[model samples]
Target: MAGLEVPTWDPQTAMLIGAILFEAIILYVGYGGLEKLVGPRLMELLVGGESGVSQ
Candidate 1:
């Protein structure tokens, strides 16, 4: 019987995973920034209000 083999470190796979993670982080931050910049304006346009509620 043969012994168990060790797993090899794959540089390409590591880089690909790292790049995907980095892109996800960037997209998250960018979306948050975009939401902060445009969310209020969009809400105001859609709701048409100087105040939060009419009450």
Candidate 2:
């Protein structure tokens, strides 16, 4: 019976990992921008207008 051998480094695997990482970064930035654009409006709608404390 043959034992399992360790896999060699492969460029294709590296590229796949890099693609996933790149996509994750893009999604993070997109969501951050969307949050910045809509977050205050959404908070005001939920809380029924601004707080009494001055900014």
- List TM-scores for all candidates, in order: 0.75, 0.71
lDDT of candidate model 1 versus the reference: 0.88
Candidate 1: Cα lDDT at 30: 100
lDDT of 1 by residue, 1-55 (tens): 3678777879999899999999999999999999999988888888877544766
RMSD of each: 3.9, 4.9
Whole-structure CA lDDT of model 2:
0.86
Q: Who wins the TM-score comparison?
A: 1
**What number of backbone clashes does candidate 1 have, counting pairs of residues 3 or more apart or in separate chains?**
0
lDDT of 2 at 47: 72
Which residue runs does candidate 1 get wrong by more than 4 Å? 1-6, 50-54
lDDT per residue as tens, model 2, 1-55: 3668776879999899999999999999999999999988887887756653445
